[model samples]
Target chain A: MELGPHILLALLESAVSTAVLALTAIGLALVFGIMRVVNVAHGEFFMLGAVLAWWITDQLTAFSPAVGFAVALVLSPLLVGAIAYASDRIVINRVDYDPERTIVATVGLLYIFQQISLMTFGPDARPVEPPFNTRLAIPWLEITEQGWAVYWPWGLSITSYKLAVIAISIVLLIGVWLVLSKTRYGLIMRATQQDKDIAQAFGIRIERVYGLVFAAGGALAAMGAVLIVPIQQAHYLMGGDPLLLSFIVVILGGLGSLSGTLVAAAIIGLSNGMIAVFFSPTLAKILATLLVALVLIWRPAGLFTRSSR
Target chain B: MLELSGIAAAYGRVKVLHDVSLSVCEGEVVCVLGRNGAGKTSTMKAIMGLLPLSAGQITVDGTRLDTLPVDHVAKHRVAYTPQGRRLFPELTVRENLEIGLMARGEDSRVLDWVLELFPRLEERMNQLAHTLSGGEQQMAAIGRALCINPRFLLLDEPTEGLQPSIVALIQEVVSTLSKSGVGVLLVEQRIDAVLSIADKVAFIENGYSREVVPAATLKTDRSLLEKYVGV
Candidate 1:
C-alpha cells in the first residue's frame, strides 16, 4: 500500500477534477432530470461565472484583493442563477419546456451568453487571484536512489485553493443532497419529475418550480467556475470542455437522476484527472469522449440506474 | 358545488365534448356513466382545465373555473384523481401525499387524517407507490386527493379493475367523503357499483352529457340502466 509522490500528486489532481466535473455535470443532469431539457448552454453558465469573477475582482481589487475575490465568489453564482431564472421564465417555460425545443433554446442561450461574455470580457483569457495563498507542498513517500523516503520534491507543490475547492465542493454537494432529499423544495421538484401533469393537479405551480430549478442548475455551474477560475483562466470559449465533459457524466450517470449523476461524475472526473496527469489534457478529453460513446451505446441510462428510462 | 352548463371543449380541430352540462351539490355523489369514448373523461379534463374549453363555462359554488389554469383549478379546492391512479410512482406514499399538502401550503397534519381514512396506507406510508398493488395504488391516489381537503373530489374510474372487496372499500370511502360534505363527481363505467352510492347520475354520449336522473330511480328500473348505459 506504499504510494509514490508522483502517483499521489496525480491522484490529488484527479480528485480536484472529479469535484469540479461533478458540480458542472449535476446541473446538466438536474435540468434534464426535472424539466427534460438538454441545456447546451450549461458551460456558458460556467464561463460566465469565471468571467464575472474576473470582472468583479478587477472592480473590487481597489478595496483589497481578498475582499474583491470574496465578493466575486459570493456574487457570481447568484447573478448567474438569477439570469438563468429569467431565461427560464422568458424562453424555456414559454415553450412549456419541450425536450426538443429546449435543446434548441439552450443552444441559442449558449450563443447569446457567449457573445455577451465576448462583448464584455473580450476575446482574451482573464485571470483572477485566489482569495488566499494557494501554494503548498504535498508530502509523500518517494522511491529514489537511496530508498523510499518521505519528502516534498520540487514540482510536488499542491495549491491550498485547490484543496479549498475540494472541501467546498464536498460540503456543497452534501447540501444539494439534503435539499433534494429533506426539503419541501426538493419534494416538489421530485413530484414534478415524476409527472408534470399530475404535479400540477396537486396544485403545484410547475412553471415557477421549473424556473427556480433552472436557476439552481445555472447556479451550480457557476459555483464550479468560481472555485476553479484561479487555476484555469476565464475565457469566452472555456465552456466547451466543461459542457462536453458534463454531458459525458450526465449520459453515463443516467439523464435526470441526481444520485446517478454524482456516481458518474466521480468516475469520469477521477479518470479524466488521472489521465490528464499521466498523459495530456487533450488525451484525457479524448478518452472521456470515447467513454461517453461507449456508455451511450451500451448503457445509455447511466451506470447507477438499473435500466434505460 | 360544481356546475357545468353547455360546456364544450376540443383537443385540436377535433372536438371531444360538443355539449355537456352537469351539477353536484354539496355532500352529493353524482356519478357519470357511459360507454367507452363517450367524453366521460373529457368532461373531467375540461372541468380541471386540462384542455381549453371551445365554448361554455365551468363554475364551482358560483365561482368561474373554466378560464383558470390546470394548477389554478386545484387552487380553488378542486382535486382530480385521473385514471390509472397516476400517483407519483417514484415517490413514497408520504411524499405523494405531501405533494398534495404542499400544493395548498398546508401542514403534515393532513397525513394523520388521510391514514385514518385509508388505514392500509398507514402501514405502507414509507413505501414507494409503484410497489403497491392495484387496489393499494387506488387507495393512495384517493388519499393524495383527500390531502388537499378539496371542496370537490373528482374521481375518474375510481373502482376500475378492482376486486370486489376493494370496490366495496372504495364505495365506503366515497360514501363517507360525500357524507362529510366533499362534493363527489365520479366518472365510472361499473353501473351497479357506482349506483350504490351515487345520489344522482348523468350519462355522457356522443360528446354530450344527458340522461340526468336520480340514482334511486335508475336502480329500481333495470331497463333504464340498459336504455341509457346500453351495456
Candidate 2:
C-alpha cells in the first residue's frame, strides 16, 4: 500500500472509531452535566449491550443473520436502559447523588455488572455477525502521463457494515441534538442541569428526570456497543477501554458540552487511529494521556468550556 | 388566602426562623420586611417547601402546604422567585419562562401576559439569561414565576439589586397582579418600594415576625421600621 492509501485507510478507520466514541462519550457527558454524577460504570453498560447483543443474536440463529442483528439492535439498548433506570432508583438515588459517594457506588456497580456478565455470558469472546457486509474498493485520483487518472488501489477499501455504522451514528447524533434543543422535555432537562433548586421550584420532578437521564445515558452507550459489536467481539472485560477512552474524551472535550464531546472525540479518535497505524497503539495511548495532563494543567475546564463555569 | 402561622424552620441543627407568621388574602400584597439574616428568606423557603418547617403550619385556602413536597407546592398554583434571581443561566429568557409553564403542563398562552408585564424581557427573549443585565435577569426570574399562573406568588428580594426604573416596573407589575386577584408574599429590604405596593407590612427581627401593620400605619409611624428593620 502506498502512503496515500494508507493514510486514507487510517482516516476511514478513525471515522468509524470517532462515531462510536462520540455516542458513548455523549452519554457520560449528559449524566455528568445534568445529575452531577460521575457514572463510573458507564463502560459496563457498553459491555452489557455487547454481551446482550451476542446473546440475542445467538438465541435467534434459527433466523437469518440480518434478522437477528436487527432484533439485537433494538432490544439491547432498551434492556440496558431498564437496568440503568433500576440502578439509578435503587442505588444512585438512595445515595442522594452525593458526588463522592456516587463515584464509589458506581464503581461497585461496575464490578457487579462485570461479575454478572461473567456468570451468564461466560469468559468467551463472542462475535455477532454483521447484518450486511461487503468490501467496496475505493479509487484514488493520480496524476499520470495522461493527466488525471482514477485507479482502484489495492487494499484501499471499506466494509459496508463500517460505513453503515458511521451513517447511523450521524443520524442518531442529530436526533439527540434535536431532542435537546427543540423539545419541551429538553428545556426541563436543561433547567434541571443549570439549577436543581430552581427547577424543583418550577415543579420539575428532578428525581424522575435524574432516573430518565441515567437511563438515557446507558441507552446511548448500549446503542454504541450494539453498532460496534460486529467489529469487536463481546467479552466481560471489553468495557475497560471504552470507559477510559470516554473519560478522556469527556474531560478533554469539556464537561457537559455536547459539541465539545464531538470535537474531542474526533481529535482523539483520529490521532489514536493514525498513531496506532503509523507507530504503536501503546504510543498512541501514552500521547493521549499526556494530552489530557496538559489540558488539566492549562485548561482544567476542558478545551471548549468558558472559564466562568 | 395564603397563610403562614407560627412557622418555625431550621438549617441543619441551627434554627433560622422562629414563630414567623403572616397572611395574604386574594387581591392583596403582603410584604415581609426584615434586616439581613432576620429569617425573611427562610420564611419564603418554608412556604415553598424548600425548607422543612420544624413546627407550625402553612396553608393556602385551607390546603395544608407544609406537608407537600417542594415540587408539589408549585403544582398547587404556588410559584416562587428566590433570592439572587435564580434563572437557568445557560437557557434563553424564553426557555426560563417556558419551564414555569411546563411545570403546570400549561401552554405558552400565559407567556404573553408575562411578556406584557416585562416588555424589556420580550426584547431579550432569545438572549441567554446569564448574558442579560441584572434588571433583565430579575425581570426574567419574575416572568418565569408568572408563567405558572400562580394563585399565590412568593418573591424573595425581587428588586434587591435592580435599578430604580426596574424596581418601579416591578412594583407596577405586583400591583397589577394583585388587582387580578393573585396573592403576593413579597420579601423585601427596600421599605419605600415595599410600602408603595404592599397593602400590609410584616416586620421581622431576630428570627421572629415582630408585627403586622397596615402600610398606611408605617407611613405615619416610622418607629417600627427603625425598631425592627433599623432602616
Candidate 3:
C-alpha cells in the first residue's frame, strides 16, 4: 500500500473514533459539569439507547430502512431521556443530589438498567441495518501511474454509512453548542451549573434543572448509541467501551468544559482508531488508560480550562 | 411590610439566633448591627428561609412566610443578598444580574434597569463577576437584588469591607431604595455608616437580639452604640 492510502486510512479511523467518542463523552461531561453528579449509569443509558434503537428499528423495518433508522434515531434518545428524568426525580433527588450519595444511587441505577436490558433484550447481541450502505472506492496517486492520473486504490475504501455517523455527530454536537449558547434554557443551565444555591435562591428551580440536565446528558449518550448500533451490534454490555472511552476523554478534556471534552475526544478517538488499526485494539485501550492517568496527575482541571480572567 | 416575631434558629442543637424579632416597613431602613458571630447573619438567613426556624413566624403583607422555602419567600416580594456578595463568580455581570430578575419572570429590560441603577456595572457588563472590584461586586449584588423590584430587600453586610466613597454609594442606594417604598433590612458591622440612613437599629449580642432603638436617639445616646457595637 502506498503512503497516501495508508495515511488516509489512518485519518479515516481517527475520524470514526473521534465522532463516536465525542458523542458519548459530551453527555458524561455535561452531567458531571453541571450537577456535579458522576453518572455511573451513563453507560447504561448508552446501552439502553442502542438496545432500544435496535428494537425500534426492528419494528419499523417493515417500512423502508431509511424510515426505520430515522424513527429509531428520534425515539431512542427521547426514551432514554425520559427514563433518566424519572430516575433523577425518584432516586437522585431523594439523595438530595449529594456527591457521594448520588454516585451510589447512580451505581444502583447502572445495575438496574443493565439488568432490565438483559431481561427484556434477552441477552442477545443484535444489529440494526444501516439506512444506506454504499462503498466509496478511495483514490490515491501511485508513483508508476501515467502522468499522475487519479487511480482507485486496490483496497482503500469507506462506507457511506460511516460517513453519515461522522456527519450526524457534527450536527448533534453543534446543536448542543447552539442550545447551550443561544437559548434561554442554556443560560439557565449555565447559571445553575455556576452556583446551584444562588440559582435556587434566584428561583431557577434547580431541582427541575438538574432533572432536565441529567436527562439531556443521558439522551446525548443514547443518541450516540443509536448512530453506532448499526456498525456495532446492540448488546446488554455494549456500552462498556463507549463509557470507558467517554470517561477517558472527559477526564482528559477537563471534567466540565465542553470544548475540552471535544478536543480530548478527538485526541482519544484518533489515537484509539489509529492504534487499533496498526496494532491490537487491547493495546489502544491500555494506551488510553495510561494517557488518562497521566492527564489526571498533570492538569486535573483539564487541557482546555480557560484561565480565570 | 415584613415582620419576624420570636424567631429562633439553630444549627444542630446550637442555637444561633434566640428570640429575634424585627420589622421593616416601606420607606424604612432597619439595620441589624452586631460583631462577627453575633447571630446577625443567622437572623438574616432565618428570615430568608435558608435555615429552619425552631420557633416563631415571619409575615409579609399580612401573609405568613416562615414556613416557605427561600425561593418561595423571594417570590413573596422578599429578595436577599447573602454576605460575600455571592455573585456567580464565573458568569458575566449581565448574566449575574439576569439571575436575580429570573425569579420575578422579568425580561432583559430589567438588565437595563439594573445597569442604570449601577452605572459602573454598564462599564464592565461583559466582565466576569470574579474580576469585578469589591465595590463593583457589592454594587452588582445590590443591583441584582434590586432588579427583582421586591417590596422588601434583605442585605447582609453590603458595606462590610469598602472605602468611604463606595460606602457612601451604598448608603445612597439604600436610602433611595427606602425612599422608593422598598423596605430595607440591612445587616451592618459599622453602626456609624448605617446610622444616617437607618430608621431603626437592632443590636445583637452573642446569640441574643438586644434592644431596638431609633437611629436618631443613638446619635446623642452613643452609650448604646459604644457598648453593644464596639466603635
Candidate 4:
C-alpha cells in the first residue's frame, strides 16, 4: 500500500481509539474532579462491561446478534453502575473519601473485580460478535495521464460498525457535556467540585452526589468497553492497559478537565495508532510513557490547567 | 429567634469555642465582636453545624440546629456566609446564587430579590465568582446567602478586606435585611462598622463570650471595645 493509504488507515484506527478512550477517560475525570478521589478500579469497570457484554450475548444466542448487542449495551452499564454505587457507599464513603485511603480502597476493589471476573468468566479471552460489520472499499485520489481520478485502493477500507461506534461515542459525549453544563445537577456537581464544605453549607447533599458521580463514572467506562468489545476481546486482564492509558490521559489533559481529557485522548490515541502502524506497539507504549514523563516534568499541573492548582 | 446557648465546640482535641452564648431576634442585628483567634468564626461555624458542638445547643425558631447534619442546617431557613466569601470560584455569580436558592428549594423569583438587593451583582452575574472584585465578591457572597431567603443569616467578616464604600454598603444591607425581619448574626472586627448597624453587640474573647450589651451602650463607651476587642 502507498504511504497515503497507510496513513489514512492509521488515522481511521486512531479515531476509533480516540472515541472509546474519551468515553472512558471522561468518567475518570468526573470522579476525580468532583469527588477528589482516585478511582484505581475504573478500568475494572470497563472490563466488567466487556465481560458482561460477552455473557449477555451468549445467553441470548437464540436472538439475532443485533438484538443481543442492543440488550447488552443497555444492561451492562446499568449493572456496572449499580456495582460502582454499592462500592462507593460501602467502602468509599466509609473511608470519608480521604485521598490516600480511597486510592488504597479502589486498588483493593481493582483486585477484587479482577479476581471475580477471572473466577466467573474464566481466564480465556472471549469475543462478542459485532451487531453489524460491513466493509466498504476506500477510494484514493491519483493523477492519471488524463486528469485526477479516484480509484479503489487495495486493503483500504473501514467497517460500518467502527463508524457507528464513532457516531455513538460522539452523541454520548455531547450528552455528557449537556448534563454537566445545562442541568441543575451539573451546577451542584461543579459547586461541590469547587468547594465541598461550601457546597455542603449551601445544602448540597455531597455524599449522595459522590455516590451518583462514582456510579456515572463507572457506567461511562463500561459504555466505552462495550463499544470496543467487538474489536477487542474481553479478557480478565484487559483492564490494566486502559487504566494506564486513562491515568496518563487524565494527567496530561489536566486532572478533572473533561475537555482536556478529550483533547489528550485524541493526541495520545492518534500517536499510539500512528506509531503502532509504522513502528511497534511496545514502542508506542514506551513513547507515550515518555511523553507523560516529559509533560509532568515541564507542566506538572497539566497542559490545559489554567493555574497551578 | 436564632439562639446559641453555651455552645462549646472543639477542633479535634483543641477547644475553640467555650461558653459562647448569643441570640438574634427577628428584625435584630446582633454582632459578635472579637479579636483574631477569638472564635468568632468558630461560633458561626458552630451555629451552621460546620463544627461539632461538644456541649450546648443551637436552635432556630425552637428547632434544634446542632442535632442536624451540616447540610441539613441550611434547610432550616438559615444561611451562612463564612469568612473569605467562600464562593464557588469557578462558577458564575448566577450559579453561586442559584446554589443558595437550591438549598431552600426556592424558585428563580427569589433570585430577583437578591439581584435587586445587590444590583451591582446583576451586571456581573455572568462572570466567575473568583474574577469579581473584592467588593463584588462580597456582594455575591451576601447575595448568595440571601438567595435562600433565610429567616436568619450568619455572616463571618463580610466586611473584611473590603473598602470603606463596600463596607458601608454591607452595613446598609444588614440593616435592610434586619428591617425585613431577618435575624442577622454578624461576626466583625471593625467595632465602628458593627456599632453602626448592630442592635446588640456580643464580645468574644479567648473562645468565650465576654459580654453582651446594647449597641448604643457600646457606642457611648469605647472602653468596652478597648477592653474586649483591644481596638
Candidate 5:
C-alpha cells in the first residue's frame, strides 16, 4: 500500500487540529497557572463566541464571507472578554480563594451560561454558512473551497476551510506568545501569577491583574470558537468537548506552564485525531483519558513545568 | 522621618503591639530588640501598613501612613524588607527588583542606586530569587525595598537566619543608609549586633516597649540587657 498520501493527509489534519487545540488550551493553562483557579465556566466563553459568530453571520445578510469571518473574529473575543470581566468582578472575585468553593462557583457559572445560550439562541445547532464557495486545485491533490488541500492519493477530498482553521490558530498562538514574553504588561502578569502577596508588595495592583488575566483567557476561548464555527456548527452546548480536552492539555502540559500547554495541546490533538482515524472516536477518547491518567500517575506536574518561584 | 505613636494593633482578636511609640530621625539607625513574641515584627508590620492599627498614629514625615494601605505607604516614601525576605520566588533577581520599583513610577534613579549597593545582584540579576542563597536573597530583598527610594526603610529581622558575615554586611548597609539620610527602623533579635550600628535602641517586652536609650549606654551596660531581655 502507498503510504505517501495517507501519511500526508494525516499530517495535514493533525497540524490543523493541533493549532486549534493549542489556542483553546492556552487560556485554560494561563488562568490556572496564575490564579490557581480552575475556571470551569471557561468553556461557556467559547460557546458564547460560536453562538455570536453564527448570529453575526446571519445578521450581516449581505456581507461577503471574508467580511463575516472578519467581524466574527474581531467581535466574539472582545464580547466574551467583557462578559468574563464582569463575572470575575461580580461573582468569582467575591468567592475568595477557597479552592472547593471556586470550583463549584465556576462550574455553576458554566451551566448558567449554557442555559443562557439555550434561552437566547435556542437548542438547535445553527450552521454558519460561509458567503461564497470557491475551490482551489493543487494538481491531483484537490483543495476545498476554503483553501485546504484535503485530498488523498485515492482521489478522496476534504474542505480547505479546515486548513484555514489551522492557519488562523497558528497566528493566534504566536500572538499570545509574543504578548506574554515581550510586553511590560505581560511581565507584571507573570509576576503576579507567581506570588500575589509578593506582587502586591512589589506595587502591582492584584485585582486589576486578575481581571486582565481572566479577560485574556476568555478572549482566547472566544477566538477558538470563531475558528471552529465554520467547520463545527454553533450549538448551545458546543463548549463541552473543548472544555474537557483543554483540561487534558493543561494537565499533560503541567499546571501554569505556557509552553507546556502548547506541547500538550499538540500531543492531544495529533494522538486523538490519529487514534480516531484508525479506530473509533470513542476509542480515541478513551485513549486520551488513559494517557491523562498515566501522566497523572507518573508525573503529576505534567510533561513540562514552570519554575514556580 | 518615620514616627509611630500610641499605636495599637492585633491579629484577629489577639492584640500584638500595644500603645507602641517609636521614632527614627533622619540619618539615624533605630533598632527594636526583643525576644520572640515581643511584637518586634508587629511594629514593623504596622509601620509598613501591613497590619491595621486598631488605635494609634503612623506618620512618615507627618503623612499619616497608618490610614493608607500598603501600596500607598510605599508612595509616601516608606519601604519594607519583610522578615523571611518574601522575594518573588518565580521571578529573577532583576525582575524582583523591577517589580518592587513599579510604584516609584518614572524614576529609574532608585533602581540604579539599589544595583550599585549590591553589585553581586548585577552578576546574578537573571537568576530566580529562590535559587539565590540566604545572603544573596537578603541583599535582593533589601535592594528591592531600596528601589522605591524610600525616606524610611523598615527592615524586619534582616539577619535572622543569615551567616555572621552576611549580618555584618547588612549592618554596613544600614549604616550606609543612615549616612545617606534614610531613616531606618531595624528590628533584630541579636541585641549586640544591632547595638553596634544603632543610634538608639528600644527593648520590647511582651507587647510593650521599654524606655528608649542611647545605644552607647546600652552597649556598655550588660545589666540593662538582663533587666529587660534575658536568655
Candidate 6:
C-alpha cells in the first residue's frame, strides 16, 4: 500500500477509534466525577454491555439488524446502569466513604463479573452482527450500512458501524454536557461532586442523585460497547483493553473533567493509529503509556482538573 | 416553629447530646451557646436528622421530624447551614445556589432574594466556590442555604473564621431573617454577636442544655457565660 493513502486511512481509523474511546472514558469520568470512586470494575460493566448486545441479537434473530442495533444501543446501557445502581446501593453504600474499602469492593466485583462472563459466554469470542452492516460507498472508500469501510484510498478501510459509533459518541458527549450545564439536575450533580456533605445539608437527596449518576455512567459504557462490538468482536475479556484505555484517558485528560477526557482520547487514538502504521501496535501502546506516565509525573491531577471537590 | 425535647445523641456509645430541649417560634432568633465540645453542633445535627437521636423527639410546625430523613426534613420547610461554610468547593457559585433551590423545589424565588442580600455573589456567580475568599465563600454558603426558603433555619457556627466585617454581615442577615418572620436557631462562639441578635439564648454545656432565657437577661449576666459557655 502507498504511504499517503495508508496514512489517510490510518488517520481516519484513528479518528473513529478516538471517538469510541472518548465515549467509553466519558462514562468512567462521569462516575468518578460524582462519586470519586475509581470503579475498578468499570471494565466489567463494559464487558457486560457487549455480552448483553450479543444475547439480544441472538434472541431477536428475526428482527432486522437495524432493529437489533437500536434495541441493543438503548437496552444494553440501561441494563448495565440498573446493575451498577443496585450494586452501588447494596455494596458500595455500606462502605461509608472508605476509599480503601471501595477499591477492594470494586476489585472484587471486577473478578466476580469476569468469572460470570467466562462461565456464561464460554470464554470464546463471538461476533455481533447488526443489520446496519449493509453497504454504501464514498469515492475511494466502501462503507457498509453498519459504517465500516471495506476499501478506501489505502486498501481495505474501516468499518461503517465504527464510524457511526464515533458520530454517536460526539452526539452523546454533547448531550451530556448540555444536561450538566443547562439543567437543574446538572447543578445538583456539580454541587454533590464538590461536597457531598454540604449538598446533603442543603437538603438534596444525594443518594438518589448518586444512583442516577452511577446508572448514567454504566449506560454510557454500555453504549460505547454497543458501538464497538461489531468492529472489535464481542468477548468475555473485551472490557479490559477499553478499561485500560479509559484509565489512560483519565490520566491524560485530568480525572473528572469531561472536556479533557475527550481531548485525551483523541490524542491516544491518533497516536495509536498513526504510530502503529509506522511501527508496531505494541510499540504504539507502550509509547501511549509512557506519554501518560510522563504527563502524570508532571501534573499528577491530570491535565485539566479544575478543582471539582 | 421548631422544637427539640429530651434529645439524646451518641456516636458509638459516646453521647454528645444529653437531654437537650429547645424551641424557636416564628420570627424568633434563638442562639445556642457553648464551647468547642459543648454539644452545640450536635443539637443542630439532631434537628437536621443528621444524627440519630437515641431518645426523645423533634418537631417542626407540629410535625414530627425524628422519623424523616435529612432531605425529607428539608422538604418540610426546614433548612440548615452546617458549620464551616461547607460550600461545594468544586461547583461555581451559581451552581451551588441552584442546588439549594433544586432541593427545596417551588421556592426558587429565594435565590433572587439571597442574591439581593449578598450582592457579591452576583458578580462572582460564575467563579468556582473554592476560588472565592473565605468571607465570600461563607456568604455563598449562607446564600445557598437560604435559597431553600425554609420556614425554620438552622445555622451552625455561621460566623466562624471570618473577618469582622463578614461577621457583621452574617449577623445582619440573621437579624433580617428573624424580622421577616423566618425562625432561626443559631449556634455561635462569639457571645456578643449572638447576644446582639438573639431574641433568646440557651446555654449548652457538658452534654446538657440549661434553661433558655431572654437574650436581654443573659447579656446582663456575663458570669453565667463564664461559668457555662466559658467565654
DockQ scores for all the models shown? 0.79, 0.87, 0.64, 0.89, 0.53, 0.60
| Candidate 3 residue-wise lDDT, A1-309, digit = tens | 777798798888679768977988999999999999988889999999999999998998779989999999999999999999999999999998899999899999988999999988888799899999999888887556356677887778989999999999999999999998777789899988887766766777777888999999999999999998888899998777888899898888888889999999988898888888888899999999998888778777777885444
* CA shift of A215, model 1, Å: 1.1
Question: Worst ten-residue run, lDDT, model 4 chain A?
Answer: A300-309
lDDT of 3 by residue, B138-225 (tens): 9999888877778899999998789999999899888888888989999987777888999999888886778999999988888887
Worst 10 residues of 1 chain A by lDDT: A1-10
lDDT of 5 by residue, A55-96 (tens): 888888687877987888899899999998888888778997
- Name model 4 segments beyond 4 Å from true: none
TM-score of chain B of each: 0.97, 0.97, 0.95, 0.98, 0.96, 0.97
Candidate 5 collision pairs: A33-A256, A134-A145, A148-A160, A309-B89, A309-B90
Q: Against the true structure, what is each candidate's TM-score?
A: 0.94, 0.97, 0.95, 0.98, 0.90, 0.87
Where's the lowest-lDDT run of ten residues in candidate 2 chain A?
Answer: A300-309
Q: What is candidate 2's CA lDDT for residue B52? A: 96
- List, residue by residue over B95-182, the lDDT tens digit for candidate 6: 8887778776745467889988998899999998889998998899888778888788888888889899999999999989999999
True lDDT of residue A95, candidate 5: 90
Instruction: Kindly provide the TM-score of model 2 when superposed on the true structure, using C-alpha atoms.
Output: 0.97
lDDT of 5 by residue, B132-220 (tens): 99999999999988988877888998998889999998898899999999989998888879888999987888788787989999767
Over 4 Å off, model 1: A1-3, A141-154
Interface RMSD of 4: 0.7
Off by over 4 Å in 2: none
Query: After TM-score superposition, what is the CA distance of residue B201 in candidate 6 from its true location, in Å?
Result: 1.9
lDDT of 6: 0.83
Worst 10 residues of 5 chain A by lDDT: A131-140
Error of 3 at A72 (Å): 0.5
True contacts kept of 6: 0.81
State what share of the real interface contacts each candidate retains.
Answer: 0.86, 0.90, 0.60, 0.90, 0.45, 0.81
